[model samples]
Target: MASPVLLCVGLSHREVPIAVREQVAVSADDLPEKLRRLKAIPGVREAFLVSTCNRLEIFSVADSRTVADDLLREVGPAGAPHAVVRSDDDALTHLFRVAASLDSMVVGEAQILGQIKDAHETAKLHGAAGAYFARLMAKAQSAAKRVRTETQIARGAVSVASVAVQLARKVLGNLAGRTVLLVGAGEMAQLAARELHQSSASELLVANRSSARAEEIAREVAGVAVNLAELPALLERADVVLCSTGAREPVVTHEMMVRALKARRYRPAFLIDLALPRNVEPSVNELENVYVYDMDDLERVAAGNRELREQEVARAEEIVREELAALRKADRERSAVPVLARLREHAHGVAKSEVERTLAQLAALDEKQKKAVQAMASAIVNKLLHGPTSRLREEQGGPLAEAAAELFGLAEGPGADPVANPVANPPEGEAADVLPISGRK
Candidate 1:
């Protein structure tokens, strides 16, 4: 038997550029298949994967460092500088941090927490999550809720949509009484609409391929709705345009912008492209007075907000540390379970073996008397093992457990039967940087 080891490996916005992040991100539709494949890998006991615009992370339990290496190879390009690995305690801590949104590009964004939940649930649905991940994910979710409840980590505009609105304000000044255009009516577009509305964007205009969806969002914001075919015209009238559509190709091409810019006499328009495949053509960014910003640009804005939330971030970190310690303590207690179970089995086996031997000599006794003798033998074994069992549970990672194993002749050495010494040894050569699970019993 091999002791389970937790491992994580992948890249995030913290280390990789958006282009690279985009290249490796697995779509939500593709996640279940990826998770099943991960569980199929040799040495992996369980697996869960989180893939978002800002990060791509794989969380798993396996038998050795090879599992981490294997997972990295599965998800990341060879020698990818953006990808990194952590194991055991460090991996556990990382999971908590990610769940709590402390490791997010926006530090305290609420979306990452939901994204983590989605990933965990997907893994569970596919039968990839096991006992280890069940507890870990529960704790991570609890930690995230606690951070939001106890601190201001999630306060203010902590989303990409809000950040984009803030950037628009930075370029075009207060959105008060300004005309704002929303291009998709999707979640991000809706969020941007609300943010701009709160900023007193005087007029809201919605344009989408589906006139009904566009009208729905436009009505909600008390704005005018139009067909996406009218975007070239709307672009001329609006001051800021936020786009998040499902189009496979650019919705706003360079020629379209050139025409829109010429129509507005190049009156300086701010454009935000939130779609993954990008709603606006990249080349449109080169047009004069046609400012185009995408997910990466909003990240820069979020970074500034992160600086203001440094105190909240610090407070959040303290909470994670406290929770992590409690988690590890419980983990340490669990490590003793197998050791205690084996000890109990070995003791009972001896008692049974001896009881049978004594029964042959007790043929002179009545059946009732022989039953009493057998009960007494079992009781004595229980009493004899009770003290050691308590110590084994109480003093995990201490010498007493190993000492008791030796005393009972259960410890494995040269010529010892592997079947008899079923307790697994701690993994070796686990890099200090990788961080092994501590306090193995």
Candidate 2:
């Protein structure tokens, strides 16, 4: 049977606008159903979906390369126009890069790896991922770990949250005594809260629809949890407001910010909107002394950070390439296994049959003499088979194995098994290990 092809199809921040991305974005509650639909496609053997704020991709192991077309269709018309497809090695490479955060808008950001792992676990839970995806996920995680450990790509303000904090500092001059309000308890909000805390912000207030989640995040940053109902009061007190809620409408309206600004006596208020569909209204930026930065603004700052880490980014890419090469080499060696097994089995059968016939003809010989003859025959068979066996292994069971099968008249097909019809009184000692083609030391 032909090997399954690796395929990746999706749209990312590089190709799709945030508005279109928002339209195609899959919520946590909807991911399982989406994955189920993808897995049901004809020729799709295994599949998983990765949906983040910046990208939505489907990774699959399928029987046909054209499965990309089906995957694009699954993405729907809005995303299909902006989608890109990668197959085989290119697909594998893209997955590794994503896990390593090399393909992120903020390259070398630390969140993509965890996001990918979560997506993979969700796929496996819903029966969408199989053996192929399990193995691929493991390799991608290993590559990400290596990049983090061996390179400096993750150093400094690499994440969008951290970059947003940096921008806040540049605008307000200092975060040291600033009261920062986090308007959500999501991963991005928690990250931004941590960044602000590390910058020595005097107080951190977490406001969320879920008080328990807000309290959880607040405790981690040595802050307080406030009720979302009191957002206007929290906004008035906060010098910097970071919002990353999942709400469809703008959570912080222009009117709310205007009132907060009047309450603060027109002091500069820095707002970072890290959510898709945007938590803060765009009109809020029109207000004087109020600076609002959204995902695109954060990305521009992140681009400068990427420029600063060009060397480390290059190193991370090298690690990804190394992992990809190693996986391909292992796969090649595994492909050669069946051919080598057949070659050894064929040779052992011929050696054993001839030895048995010769021994039967010399019936006058004693048991010890017969045993000695058997050992000699076995040793000769081992010596004769050694060169061919080594050559097959060296060639990773490629063309040499096929040629050897042809020469020895061995059966060749998906179901071919030379050992099914065993040779009676098989060769002993050194030749014993040689009988099983995979047993070579």
Cα RMSD for candidates in order: 5.4, 9.6
lDDT of 1 by residue, 222-335 (tens): 778988887888888888898888666788889988988899898888998876657888888899887898878778878888899999999999999888867655654554
Clashing pairs in 2: none
Per-residue alpha-carbon lDDT of model 2 for 200-313, expressed as tens digits? Answer: 899989898999988887888788999999998988999999888889999999999999999999999999988877899999999999999887777777889889999999
Best by lDDT: 2
Error of 2 at 274 (Å): 1.5
Ten-residue stretch with the least lDDT total in model 1 = 415-424
Candidate 2's error at 129, in angstroms? 1.0
Candidate 1: C-alpha lDDT: 0.77
Q: How well does each candidate superpose onto the true structure, as a TM-score?
A: 0.83, 0.82
Candidate 2 has an lDDT of: 0.81
